[model samples]
Target: MTGNLTTIGFDADDTLWHNERFFRVTQDRFAELLQDHTPVELDRTALDHKLLAAEKRNLGRYGYGVKGFTLSMVETAIEVTDQQVPASVIQELIVAGQMMLSYPIELLPHAQKAVEQLAASHRVVLVTKGDLLDQERKLAQSGLGDLFDAVEIVSEKTPETYHEIFTRHGEGPERAMMVGNSMRSDVVPLITAGGWGTYVPHGLVWEVEYAEAPKDSPRYNAIEDLGQLPALITRIEDGL
Candidate 1:
């Protein structure tokens, strides 16, 4: 009952491993430096809201890399604080942004185990988005690349992107599944394509998107963590 999936696409960042925590740590340092200027707090939650808004506003030009995303947050910081934030601030954040991929890659508990188990009978693929060099390096460093049949670090996930994968694989909507934490990039698009999507909610979700999703959103099937993927996959494979 569990092996019906031919190809399962997994989101790299938050799904298969720990990702947002790195960003959160970096932003904490950034916030510390900005404390004196504005009475407004520069904490991670506020900063994430800013970055999420910036990402949506400048999706085309700036894209989703940490540099642009962090820089946009810096720009917002300067504007919101209504004071002169140093020009060096962005550079500092850029240095911090590099830490996302610079630090040793740490997979969530059972991440590699889960992937390895599935790869035994199904085609497991990595579908992630981020800086090309950073992402590739992290994959190689994690030593988990072999667990996947294919690795794709895409610019963003949308209907077109899923179409490319499913169409090329000769996979119709019913046989493919995408597992990830983001409803915006991962869940919505996969569901739109008539393919199933599994949403694994992370502890520190960026408030920019999911904050807007009501608790009862029917956007996708949401799970508390990636640990549920095995059973969830089994259920979905049963056609209910």
Candidate 2:
């Protein structure tokens, strides 16, 4: 519900456009590359778990996005193969990451219409955390850049980051809401910071971004998709 939300902050990656799918595809390739290095063949499930662990371990060192993911893949390969992974596999991991950086943007269902509707009645901002250049490129390619009043590419999503964005843009957290896919990155932190958070579920979630749903919180809402956003916000505006 809109309530006092004069400003709406949207997360870029999976919230507005397809993102995790590409990462999954690249991950499959990574598993294949490491197949020979391992004593036995590694299935997708097992490989995925290892990669997720690697990503979490590397988060502090490399942060997020393609570069971090690429390095994580390399690290996972080495770890799973007992540090006997070949150089060619490492090179391929780098290439996969580069390919992801260059992949085309595919907007999610009703993403454009929802954003356009929200922008019509609120100060909408694109608040996403990732590689600056990659995020910018995707925004540009998605053709959704002009719909936002402001765009922020931050290193991480935290309560302080939300405060800086809201204050810098002349909107108090009480008058703002964050709409996104990740409960960890896009919803819980802001909701805990005196702002509202609307969660729009995506098909696949990154392990690092997963968290227990805070469904009981007054400031939190979980919606099926972006298409329902306008009607939901209208109900909020009506205080229903």
Candidate 3:
């Protein structure tokens, strides 16, 4: 009942530290910057839709992180303004992206303790997707970086990705477990890879990261936060 897991993987953004909230704040700033450029009253809903569409369209080209999001914002601005958006607005958007890159990493409640506790018994790895430099900077600032046995900054998280990472870092997917906030990136694919996928919800989630819960999967789990992770792990190991 106590040794089912050999490796514990964690998601970086929103899982270990504050991430999406800062993006939300920057999005509001994005809307404000575009207000003067638009010919008519700007609809927040419509703008958000355009921005989301742009993000989806640009994912392949830009990948993920502040740099990509900033580019999407610029594209949306130009589209909404009929290619008449000011150069000054573009400068402000670039500056905003810079600010996001430099934002201080704020660890979520119980994140450090949970990782530290699990690391004592299992190989703990940071498996997150984002820009390489940005992710590295965040990890360096998080203070929890030293606790992890390994770190992986990937372009995406898929079943194959989980399988490879788990096998490389620990025994394999069967003896591994992943804890994170995104049902899509951090949970579902991990479950598909034959590992325990634990969902720890963070209130602010990116739209693209949203996915329906896999309630029927025996390996799927949901916890309110990382604070509850250790107990949940104990329950799973006990075969409850």
Per-residue lDDT value at 82 in model 2? 88
Total clashing pairs for each candidate: 0, 0, 0
Q: Candidate 1 regions off by >4 Å?
A: 1-4, 39-52, 77-83, 87-90, 211-220, 238-240
lDDT (Cα, tens digit) per residue for candidate 2, span 64-147: 899899988988888888889889889988999999999989999999999999889898999998888899999999999999
Candidate 1 lDDT over 93-114, as tens digits, reads: 6677666657888887768877
- lDDT for position 137 in model 1: 82
User: Candidate 3: which stretches are off by over 4 Å?
Assistant: none
- Against the reference, the lDDT scores of all candidates come to 0.71, 0.88, 0.92
Worst 10 residues of 3 by lDDT: 35-44
lDDT rank order? 3, 2, 1
Off by over 4 Å in 2: 1-3, 41-44
TM-score of 2: 0.94
Highest lDDT model number:
3
C-alpha lDDT (0 to 100) for residue 54 of candidate 1: 70
Question: Model 1, 202: alpha-carbon shift in Å?
Answer: 1.3
Better of 1 and 2 by TM-score: 2
Which tens-of-lDDT digit does each residue in 1-240 have in candidate 3?
148988999999999999999899999999899888886666889899999999999999999999999999999999999999999999999899889999999999999999999988889999999899999999999998899999999999999999999999888899999999999999999899999999998899889999999999999999988889999888878878
